[model samples]
Target: MSNPGSYPLPDRFDAVLAEQDAEGYRCRFAPVALSDLPDRDVLVEVRYSSLNYKDALAVTGRGKIIRQSPMVLGIDLAGRVVSSGSSRFRPGDAVVVTGQGLSETEWGGYSPWQRVRAESLIPLPPAFSLAQAMGIGTAGVTAMLSVMALERYGLAPTPRPMVVTGAGGGVGSMAVALLARLGYPVAAVTGRAALHDYLTQLGARQVLDRSALAQASPALGNERWAGGIDSVGGKTLAYLLAHTAAHGAVAACGLAGGADLPVTVFPFILRSVGLLGISSSSTPAAAQTQVWRRLARDLPASVVDSISRVEPLSRIFELAEEILAGGVRGRIILDVRA
Candidate 1:
């Protein structure tokens, strides 16, 4: 429970939507009744939300991200607790919720209020404000998990160059910045040469063309990459696989290129290279807790300005279209109340 002034509930809200239109997706707002929200242990007055690639897919119907229509469509949020039915959280607690069906099977965080399962929420780390958390959001969490996986599996070693593909995109950019900040020499690969300066500013020692990695060939070709954080799957993933150094690993998350991983097993068999699957959406509870803590501490505070674009809730639909077209850089944060 919360006092009125501290965590008073939102009385009304306008839920943002990507309506199906004759031309394509149209940005619109629809009135929502707070009573219509799903039953959950916590009611959050969402102060901040952010956009993801999945959100774009959902809005454009390029892919089916939302299982239900006329659904609210932000996948990540951070805010103060307005109401709590669980002992873990009380009114006034600052918390975050990510990747539990978010913009898919249930209501998400694109509105002024959100209902979430208590177990799915984590206390906002003391090191970052709620806005900072959303700036990192799912993209930051994914990057941390990938980096940690490389370390745990012995794929990462000091003095070896780590590579990040899709270096201009959210997960990729965050991974590059995070790795470089931690003293690893980073080779960033991206389609846009214009972002070369941007990637280098984030600590990438070198930036490569997307075609430099290309697609992998049968068996293997080059002994490169200590290990890699890859957000573009398909051929790009295969390229990393074929070229990863002996005993190197590639931690893969997004399917932006394609879901089909067309690759030869030579890297896995001969080089002992490993392809690690990082599924942030359904990561186990214990692991989820560990990764966020890492993000709060290991990731630098300067990263937010380099990798974040802020927007009002009203602009999500237009932004979604741009992101899907590969025109977006870094992360997009949504100010739900703005």
Candidate 2:
């Protein structure tokens, strides 16, 4: 990558600007001045970003993701540090910024440049390109955090297969790959039958239909899995809790299905099952760095390449709708320069 400062620096640049008014949330491409960016310790010349489900919601007004008016609408960005007031970073250093209230309290990656707190930046791994870092993005980071949490609870590869719910989505897909890459047998659950082959290709030893899981599961009936990673909350999570083996752990990340957990205490009291909740948004910098290091070691290049696709920023509007409807798969990397 060329030094960004080499070009005649423009006072303004292109950005996907969002604002909330009486008419509701609206977003579009617009020229925003450098001064319009958030007041922070570091300025990044963003090269790549990703379209996450939360970012989609923030961009489309489908969810209350951005509380402030005129916010940028991307949750993750990867690029070179243009400048930094803090000692942690300097010009030309590759870095990544995700979550940390992005697209909410702070201006985010949906621009040519972003000003963010130096504490929020993660030094990009040498093995990954800016696009590849965004390929992992927030969802992959969350998956890794869940994996770390599960391991913290002593979950490991064994004779019994681990189940990954919502296996077609970003976090679930990455979880399946990471678990399988670590030599664990994975049973992936998805509503879409079309993705069974895809999941298997990503390293799932078994592909179970979402409906079959419900039918086969009961209140403490057959403890099939050693442990599990669940993104779908509601009944799916409840089912996982009920069916996990005695002393087994389940890492619950997202509530894509629904927030309601209509479950009893049998899994906990009778089976000694553990439920670990994973929240990556506000994870401390040290922990974030730890997970990113783990990710660099665990998530192989082949798996990342298989699970991510690149698209230009112009396509985000349509991709957002597709992702919200659960029509998209894996990760979607945005080429901010394109």
Best by TM-score: 2
Residue pairs in candidate 1 whose N, alpha carbon or C atoms collide under 3 angstroms? none
Off by over 4 Å in 1: 1-10, 17-27, 216-218
Give me the displacement of residue 157 in model 1, in angstroms.
3.1
Residue-level lDDT of model 2, residues 50-98, one tens digit each, is: 9888898888888888878888889899988888898999888999987
**What local lDDT score does residue 318 receive in model 2, on the 0 to 100 scale?**
92
| TM-score of each prediction | 0.93, 0.96
Model 2 is weakest, by summed lDDT over 10 consecutive residues, at 1-10
lDDT per residue, candidate 1, 1-338, as tens digits? 46433334555668876565466555467778878678988888888998889877876677767666557777788988888899998888888877777877767888888888888888888878888888898898899999999888885446768889989999988999889877889999999999999999999999999986666555587777788999888888888888888888999998878898889788999989988989887875467788888887877666776699788877777888888888898988888876
> What do the candidate models score in CA lDDT, each in turn?
0.82, 0.87
